[model samples]
Target: MFGIRPSQKVLLLWSTPVDAEELQAMVGELKSVVGAEGKVAVENVEMLADSSHAGSHFDLILAGVLPPFQFENSLNVLGEALRILKPGGSLIVRTTDSATTQSTLKLTGFTSVSQPEDASLTDEQKRDIISPVSEITCLKPNFEVGSSMKLSFAKAPAKPSANTWNINLTDDDVDLEDPDDLLTEEDLIRPDPTTLKVCGTTGKRKACKNCSCGLKEELDAEDEKRVEENKKNFKSSCGNCYLGDAFRCASCPYMGMPAFKPGEKVKLAESTLQDTS
Candidate 1:
């Protein structure tokens, strides 16, 4: 007997047409067990196999009853039943071929496929119908199809030890030298501005067009000093000059130069030092 509980949804699958009276009687019996809060539906095996039923709709399904039944496409019928049954739903099948039915149920992805011992029936009920019935029961898996859960297989992270080194120690806790203390006596001395003068011939701050008083060399030396000073004080605005010309800005002074570490001094090639333009 199928366990038709109250408030449960059930499907009755038949392979062949039965007498209207017998069909109604079977449905009535099922309805009585399910009560008013429950539902009961009937369909032919062939139709059930082809019809589109909502997924996880039924709590139980009973096949091959009310009339002697045999599956035409056992796989498709069982598969459709599995598809529409709720997670952990039960399926009870009565077939003439028990071995094939059990095998087909397992192949259709039903779990716990088994044949139960024949149930004792009343004399009046046994006399009403006569057939060699093989009863097989199975259940849909407990978890719904396409559902997933994350699993952590790795061990938990270890806690830090109490004796771990303290990086937050105050500056006074360590013997550290001041940055200014690292400077030498020469670094402290400032250069006199008067020494950066042009040749006295022109009495101007620029070189003469044609000069024989060593004005050009003096001007060149001053230019070189200014270039050195600029190099020493240079700070990257884009912060990508150290990554090479590809990463440098259009106005970057380090364009066309090879990649170098930050704070590194860059030297121009001798060819580049010459005025080609």
Candidate 2:
């Protein structure tokens, strides 16, 4: 799920054991994917191979990489290698057609890289490349590698059920009984557009680009408050700038500038919060 460049590093891991020749080929192409200028490292390990035992640092990590049946623990292994990856580095994993992982990776810090389009490939082939390998896009938030207990284990923590927490930071009907208790979309409803305070930040509010939970409502509330303060401070600065309700009436942090073109006004880019200072 990442673009390999001449300056990047690629790591390939094999679980359930692997042959030497296949390992060699993987190493070769991985190094040569972008003009044979990048570094390639190969390792063959068993279950939980990404632990300290694997003893390798990688940038772009590939795991559970066998074909046909593909890799079983690709998700787990890729996570293991991710510990060593640079902030902007990537991990391209291969798994069966039934893998599912949480978008938490994006929330915490991980970006999926898309493959470049090729005219020679058929539409079906393209679709296959983009399809999620597990449970038809079923995924869960990954906490940490090596520490993940199997689902069969009684000690394994239960994950969030689907829609139990809406990523959109919205509620249909909130119970006033428990202000601290987390509510679900079904629990809350929109009384009206204005009454709803259609904020972009708060509990579990995430945008399209980032899955940062609860940030939207919190940020929106803070910004709304701040915008009010700014308006009061510069109530008559209409000549310098025009800010109607900075939080509700204008472009949201999620809804960025119509054009990303930089300007001299020092406006925050899309998906960014204003400097409260």
Candidate 3:
């Protein structure tokens, strides 16, 4: 058990239904541990996955029996827990699968990760509870902003490029001719913009007004699923940009981006095509 000082804020997340009497009992226990002068507040919420509480405000976060098999839900809850926990804050999770729970917490950037050797509550007390439980504890690093935590997906390997030239020449053939002789005036001169087969709307040769470039169509069901999942996870977004957390807004600098720093506005006007190239 952490020597939780007086006046330290704590958040309690539980999936099980906790009655007022049970909540009061827990709150009273916390008060006893922290001393009478300490102020203890307990929120027996069903889930702690909301982004509204995405800040380092709580000194400790105590969770009970989160759904381990449902990785997305677990990840979301862990992320929010990490985000809201203050620097040096402790996150204690009670889970049946210690290995999975430990790995998940470590992957979520929880440092000094360990399962406490001792137990706060007795075996009988734990056994009496319906939920399968054991304790794993970790602390948030003091210096981390926690905003840069991103979901990374494996990239599909690139296909080899098509043959660029049709011409074939024998190595034995002798040619001392000037290389400039191969170039026509039209090849060197910049082509007229109107004459080029560029999309009027998108200004690209590949992408037509109807978007027949096959970019959208190229996306497989798995890609679509990943996109949909990302849409749900990164709903906060970088200012107005809806692209995933990997991409930075062009209006903001690398370090000064809206994602890393709060209250930073997306100063540039929203562009349909953020990629100018």
Each prediction's whole-model lDDT (CA): 0.78, 0.48, 0.62
Off by over 4 Å in 2: 17-19, 34-37, 45-57, 72-78, 97-277
TM agreement with the true structure for every prediction: 0.51, 0.33, 0.44
74 Cα displacement, candidate 1 (Å): 1.8
Q: Per-residue lDDT for 123-201 in model 3, tens only?
A: 5465665535567779999865634654578568986668655567786776677989989998899878546755557
| Tens-digit per-residue lDDT, 1-277, candidate 2 | 2356676667666765455675676577666674555677666645345345433345566654543214544445545555666545555544433314334234334555333222233344345455334211112224433455557645767888886965553466543567646788767875654344333554232343463545456666887898766643432223322332343233333233343222234354433555455
**Candidate 1 Cα lDDT to native:** 0.78
Better of 1 and 3 by TM-score: 1
**Model 3, TM vs. native:** 0.44
Q: What's the lDDT for residue 8 in model 1?
A: 96
RMSD of 3: 32.4
Better of 2 and 3 by TM-score: 3
**Candidate 3 — which pairs collide?**
none
